[model samples]
Each structure stands twice: as C-alpha cells, then as structure tokens.
Target: MAQKSAVAARAPKKKASSWQKRDWVAAYIFIAPVTLGLLVFYIWPFFQNIWFSFNDVNKFNMSTFVGLENYIKLFSDKEVWKAFGNSLKYVVITVPAGLFLSIFIAALMNAKIRGKSIYRTLYFLPSVTMSAAVAMVWKWIYNEQMGILNTAIKAAGGSGHAWLTSPSTALYCIMLVGLWMTVGYNMIILLAGMQGISVTYYEAAALDGAGPIQQFFKITIPMLTPTIFFVLITSIISGFQVFDTIYMMIGKTNPAYDDTQTVVMLFYRQAFDYGYKGYAAAISLFIFIVIMIVTVIQLIGQKKWVNYD
Candidate 1:
C-alpha cells in the first residue's frame, strides 16, 4: 500500500490540469520583460531622483543631504514666484479659450461643404507637423518689424507694433500660436465625438420644428459634453507644461523673457544653469501639487456639466 501511494504521488497530481500550468507559464512570459525593464530603468531611477532631490547634488563627488532648507529657499525666491504667476496666467489664457475655440472650429468644419477632406487635412496638418519647424515659422511671423503680421497691420493703415518683443503682447503672442497649433487637434477629436451621435436625434429635433441654432444648443452641446470635458482636462495639463514654445521663442537675454518664463522653464534654468538641483526639485514638487489640485477641482466641477451616458 505504501509503494502504491508513493507511485501515485510521483505521478504529478494530474499535471495541474494543463490549463493551470499554461496560465502560469503564459503570465511569466508576458511579465518577464516588463519586470526586468522596470527594475533596471524606472524603479531604480525613480528612487535615485528622490535621493538626488534631498542631496546637495555635487558634480563629481558624493552629495550631502539637506533637510527642508531647499524648500524654504524656494518659497522666498522671487523668480520662482514670478514663474509660478506666469504659468497660472498662461493656463488662464489658454485652457478655456482653447477649448471653446476648438469646439467652434469643429462645428464649422462639420458643416456640409465642398472639399471637406482638403479642409480637414489642411487643419490637421499643423497638429501633425514638426513643432520645431512651426516655431521657426512663427518666429518670423511674429518678428518685431519685418513679420507678416506687422506688414499686414501697416497695409491696413494701422501702426505696426512690436509682436513677440513687446512685454505687453509677448505672452499673448505665444499663447495665440499655441492656440493655432492645437486647435486642429482638438477639432478633429471633437468632430469624431460629434459624428458618433445618432442622426435620429437631429432628425427628431428637426421634425419638432427646431432650427439649426436650436438643435445645436439642445442636441449638439449636450451630446458633445464628454468630448469637451476630455479636451478641457488634457488642454489644461498641456497648458501647464507650456515650456518648449517659450524656450524656443523667447531667448534668455530677451527683455520679454522675464514676462513669459514658465514654471518648467524656471525649473530647467535652476537645475541646469544655476546647478540648484534641490531647489529645482522643490519647485517641481510644488508645480506638481498645483496641477493636481487644479485638476481635481476641475474634475469635481465637471460632474455638474459633463455627461456620462
């Protein structure tokens, strides 16, 4: 009897029913590469960033640990505060205006028209085209004296004022370019959402003697709420991250730089140019907090406006 039991045990318990063993093997294979990569790259580097944020960050030697002194200095720094204010201004100017403008453009593009494909391609071209090239083109377009904008103003019997160089209009000019660059992307997204709505809803409204304007407010706006909500959230996040355009358009020595510098731009200058890694880390953390708070508030408010079904 003991010999029979030993033989039964050695038979492998029916081989885990096949499916169980296969599942285990498949899971391991699927996760192995991701697990290894995360350990070597993301997981390791994330800890190192945290460590570096607490240390003095010396160039070729061991870094000394500092407490909250870096954070304290950040709160008192005027330039840091200025950068924060500028970032807020940019978000205020861009987010709402951009969302509305995108929706309006999408509505216009959705209308029955000739060469609709060509019009769509033309609009979407900016969204897909290289940002570096776009910046270079806009730089010339916003040129203080010789730009197309100024020439147009002159031809229209108006004074050709400074565009990007003027402190008064520097940030606005950048914001306008950003708006133009992103409008097509937002329009395309909104248009897709609009198209997904059933034609029966519009037909019903028309049968009820509703006009185009009435149908838009009653049907189109309500149907497009989810898309608008999504666009708002994404646009706000991207607006906070408005750095590349500012860095490209406004040089370090430019007089308008002071007015247009953003939080990320300040973080870059502090971390690299001035070698204030800890302080930069503190500013970055604060910016993260600000973005989180703003996004949460917007999401909460969206509950009142955004349609789920």
Candidate 2:
C-alpha cells in the first residue's frame, strides 16, 4: 500500500484539455488587436522619440546621429529653463489651489443640499467644453479694451490693466481659467470618494461628541487621503503640461508669451515652428523625466499619509 501511494504521488499531472487550450487561444486572439495597437501607436512611438532625442532630426524627417548634443543644448538653453520655471510655478500654484477648491466644492456637494444635481451639471460644463473654446472665451474676457472684466472695472471708476498681456498677471489669469475648468470635474471625483465612505463612521463620530468640522478633519479627510493622492498626482501632471490655454490665449507675438509659456508650449514651438525636432524630443524627454520623478516621489510619500483602510 505504501509503494502504491508513492507511485501515485509521483504520477505526472494531466495536460490541459483541448478546450482549455482553445480558451487560452481565444483570450489571446481577443486581446491581440489592442496589444498590437499599443505596440504600434504608443510603445513604438515612445522608443522612437527617445531615439530621436539622441539624433539631429530635421524638418524633412531626416535624422543624423548626434548623441548627447541635443541634451547638452537643452541644459544650456535659457528658454528651456524659463519654460521649466513657468511650468513649475504653474504646478506649484494650481495643484494646491485646485485641490483646496475641489475639496471644498466636493464637501458642499456631498451635503444634503437642494439643487445638487443642477449645481453639479453647471460646474461640470466647463470641463466637458473644448479647451480651445474655453481659452478663447477667457481670452476675450481678459481683453484689454471691451472685456466684461474691464467694463466692470471702468464702471467702478477703476482702471483695468491688460490682464493677459501683463507679464505678472497673464499666467495667473490662465491659472484661474484652468481652476475654473477643472474644479467641477475634480469635485465630482472627490464627491464619489466621499459617498463611498461608510455611514457608520459618521454615526460613530456623532456618538463620540464630534461635531461636523472635527469629524471632517479627523475621519473624512483621513479616509479620503487615497482619493486626494490620486487627484494630486493627476493635477500636478496636468499643471506641468499646460499648453492649450497658454497657446490660445497668448500668441507668439504676445508680450507675456515668455511669462506664460510652459514646457509643452516650448516643445511645440521647437518641434513645429522652429523645426528643431531633436531638441524638441529632448525637451519632451525632460518633461517625461520630471513627471516620472514627481510621480515616484508621490508614490513613496503616499505610504505615510494615504489611508487605504
């Protein structure tokens, strides 16, 4: 009996049946198109862009090997630094401001308020609107002469400065527009996260003599940290890549172009306008590196603050 049991234990497992093999084949077949599409469109282009960064690529799509030359130029380029500073400033200012506003609005929306649906729809309108259209509308609103803002200032017997043309205010104006366009969408996301928290927590807090504000800080905020971290990551990335609004609102000839130009705007100018594809590729790589670093740092930092439970 012991010998027979040993032989049974040593027996080879059965091979997968033909039906199982067919199922595996079918699964791969179903995924093949999407996989191929990613390889062709995203993965290939990413590696190609990296290769382009090391070469001197011209307007004619010709490339000549000039390893590290573009990267060296990138480091020494003043405009690149300026653009990077602007982008950094954008991220620094907008991410926190946007997060605060989003949280505040989300908290309000989460409350038992009348016309909540209507308020949400109204706030969300700008996020769904075309970015170019939003930029154009905001550009008009900040127009030096006949903008509603200026008109209101004039009515109040105060002079209106050129909002989008002034170096000091142009970036801030664009930031405001960005905040307006994004706040509603982010609020919606936060609201969903808020709603997912168990009612038992709030009830428990109430029984412990915790008021609304105390409960918010002690329980709600802690529980919502994961969602907040997600928002922070995405918002920082978006802020750093700000382009459409700056491009649409401030022209190449605009006085405040330098002040408002982000890394992406600089990349666009180099790649398309100036025909420095290689240098543009380098700029793009820099952007990718910066975003990657920021994301990695956030991922590490989240271990301390982001509450999964």
Candidate 3:
C-alpha cells in the first residue's frame, strides 16, 4: 500500500486541455490590438525621438550622427535656460494657487448647499471649453485699449497697464488663465474623492463633539491626500508644458514673448520654426527628464502624507 501511494505521488500532472489553450489564445487575441497600437504609436516613437536627439536632424528629415553635439548645444543656449526658468516659475506659482482654489471649491461643492449640481456644472464648463478659445477670449479681455478690464479700471479712475504685453505681468496673466482652466477639473476630481469617504467617520467625529470645520480638517483632508497627490503631479506636468495659450495669445513679435515662453514653446520654435529638429529633440528629452525626476520625487515624498486608509 505504501509503495502504491509513493507511485501515485510521483505521477505527472495532466496537461492543460484544448479548451484552456483556446481560452489563452482568445485572451491574447483580445489584447493584441491594444498592444500593437502602443508599440506602433508610443513605444516606437519614444525610442525614435531618443535616437534623433543624438544626431543632427534637419528640416528634410536628413540625420547625421553628431555624438551628443545637440545636447552640448542645449546646455549652452541662453534661450533654453530662460525658457526653463519661465517654465519652473510657472509650475511653482500655478501648482500651489491651483491646488488651494481647487480644494476650496471642492469643499464648498461638497457641502449641503442649494443648487450645487447646477453650480458644479457652471464651474466645470470652462474645463471642457477649447483652450484656444479660452486664450482668445482672455486676449480680448486683456486688450490694452478696448478690454473690459481696462475699461473697468478707467471707469474706476485707475490707469490701465497692458496686462499681457508687460513683462512684469504677462507670465502671471498666463498663470491666471491656466488656473481658471484647470481649477474646475481638479475640483471635480477632489469632489469625487471627498464623496468616497465613509459617512461613519464624520458621524464618529460629530459624536466626539467635533464641528464641521474640525471634521473637515481631521477627516476630510487626511482621506483626500491621495487625490491631492494625483492633482499635484498632473498640475506640475501641465504647468511645465504650457504652450497653446501662450502661443495663441503671445506672438513671437510680442515684447513679453521671452518672459512668458516655456520650454515646450522653445522646442516648438526650434523644431518647426527654426528647423533644428535634433536640438529640439534634445530639448524635448530635457523636458521629459525634468518631469520624470519631479514625478519620482513626488512618489517618494507621498509616503509621509498620502493616507490610503
């Protein structure tokens, strides 16, 4: 009996049936299109861009191996540094302001207020609006002579300065528009996170004699950290890549163009306008590296504050 039991234990397991094999094939078939799409559109282009950065690519797509010449030029370009500074400033200013406004608006929307759904819809409309349209409207609103803002200032016995043309204010004006465009979307995201928190936590806080404000500070904020982290990362990335509004609102001939130009704008000018594709590729890689470092830092830092529980 012991010998028979030992032989049974040593026997080989049965192979998977034809039906199981068919199921595996079907799963791969379902996923193959998506995998191929990513490889063709995303993965291949990424490696191609990296290769372009190491060569001298002209407007005609002709490339010659340059051995980091493009990268060396990138480091020495004053305009590149200026554009990077502008982008860094944009991120530093917009991220905090946008976060505060988004949190405040989301908190208000989360309250038991009247017609909040309508209010939410109204606030969200700008987020869905075309970015070019938004930029054009703001450009009109900031017109030096005929803008409503100037008219209001003139009517109030105050002088109107050129808001979008002055180097001192142009970047800030763009930051304002960015904040307006993004706050609604961030609020919606934070609102969803706020709604996901359990009612039991609030009830428990109330039983402990905590007021609404206290409950908010104690429960809502902690529970909402994960969403806040997500918003911060996305906002920083968007702030760094600000291009459409700047392009549409500020022309190359504009006096404030240098003040408001971000790194992506510089890359656009080099790649398309100036026909230095290889140098532009290097700039693009720099932007990618900066974003990656920032994201990695955020990921590491989130361990201290982002409360998943």
Instruction: Name the top TM-score candidate.
Output: 2
> Model 2: what TM-score?
0.94
Expressed as tens digits, the lDDT of each residue in 1-309 for candidate 1 is 999999988886545768899999999999999999999998886677666667777554367899777777888989988988998898898888888888887888888988888988888898887777888899999887789998998899988877787889999999988888898899899999988889999999999999999988899999888788889888888888888888888898888999999999998998888887766777777887888898898888788665443
Candidate 1: the clashing residue pairs are none
TM-score of each: 0.86, 0.94, 0.93
Residue 275, model 1: lDDT of: 82
Alpha carbon lDDT of each predicted model:
0.85, 0.94, 0.95
What lDDT is obtained when candidate 1 is compared to the true structure?
A: 0.85
Q: With candidate 1 superimposed using the best TM-score fit, by how many Å does residue 222's alpha carbon deviate from the native?
A: 1.7
Q: Rank the candidates by lDDT, best first.
A: 3, 2, 1
Query: What lDDT does candidate 1 reach at residue 191?
Result: 94
lDDT of 3 by residue, 83-132 (tens): 99999999999999999999999999999999999999988999999999
Backbone clashes in candidate 2 total 0
Supply candidate 1's per-residue lDDT for 294.
81
Q: Name the runs in model 2 displaced over 4 angstroms.
A: 1-11, 306-309
